[model samples]
Target: MKTFLLFCWLPLTAQAACPTLLNQQLPGLMGGTVDLCQYADRPVLVVNTASHCGYTPQFTKLEALYKRYRDRGFVIVGVPSNDFHQELERNSDIGKFCLANYGVSFPMATKAHVVGPDAIPLYRQLITVSGDAPRWNFHKYLIAPGGTTVTSYGTRTEPDDPKLIGQIEDYLNGMPAPAPSVPPPAPPRLKAISGS
Candidate 1:
């Protein structure tokens, strides 16, 4: 009985190391699944994206941002969403467009809803804790290491915005704000294109 109990407890203890919010495996944009726990203890930026939205071009800046900081325990996970009616119809196309147009080499998840009751579990937790749903494509959420803190950025926020970079640096340097639950005010956003 002691041996059986010890074996059962071992897996539970290992699972406790990763936060529940990041314990999921999102389907990869290219293929297979992206085990979110692989990024545990690292600063992760999650973005809701679209292939045809005005903010689509932000992919360029996002890619550059990822390349600049990825070596220092930073990662960006692009999530193609159609909630705003702008994403391509298929995952393969999304993979190709991002690579061919923006040269995106960062991690990208397969298409997933980012708003409302049907949102993926990660987005659901993000919205619940951050109190801000994505208003349009390219909505960003910065998850601090250990997943204890999350900062929500609206569509207007640029990928290379200084404040966002500062926050990322804070996470990388292990110096997050005293209270970062609420993000700073967002800049004016462009009107979203409907039925694009």
Candidate 2:
């Protein structure tokens, strides 16, 4: 009876262990949408960012990480949020500032509220799966290649942290080669809109 019960619980336990943000389309702050399922074969790091925050300089490191590992099937997505304070003025302006000042080349979504009831749906889902919301600027979520939320790091964790880099390397080594014809879409563009 013990053996049978253990066998019956195995599937449930395994299911719980799997990370799940599959097939969800997160809106871009700029002009397109990214379907998380499309990048299931690559690990993704999502960060909640602020343009005028103290940690804004981390954008440079974040860009470097993306450039180094993007070909190895990894990506970093930035989500600008004004949750803590009115730090980010406008979504389009934030994009321009990042590119001009920090040389940021990764995808950045439009500015959105990441902490309150009006949080974007994708972030709402992210918070549910990861069990935490962005407390401040630069909170990072390292997702596994198979779309599982592997770990969540706070603002203090730099992009090049040894442990984080090791985890990314491990995920890269485990990923199978991507299909030949499925190139990633171009980086999202900033939407045309008035300032906030």
Model 2 alpha-carbon miss at residue 90, Å = 2.1
Deviation of model 1 at 59, angstroms: 0.3
- Which 10 consecutive residues of model 2 have the lowest summed lDDT? 14-23
lDDT of 1 by residue, 82-106 (tens): 9989989999999999999999998
What is the C-alpha RMSD, rounded to one decimal, of candidate 1? Answer: 17.1
Candidate 1 residue-wise lDDT at 154: 90
The residue pairs found clashing in candidate 1 are: none
Report each candidate's C-alpha RMSD, comma-separated, in the order given.
Answer: 17.1, 13.8
Model 2 per-residue lDDT at 61: 90
Local distance difference test, per candidate? 0.91, 0.81
Give the poorly placed runs of model 2, Cα more than 4 Å off: 1-20, 178-196
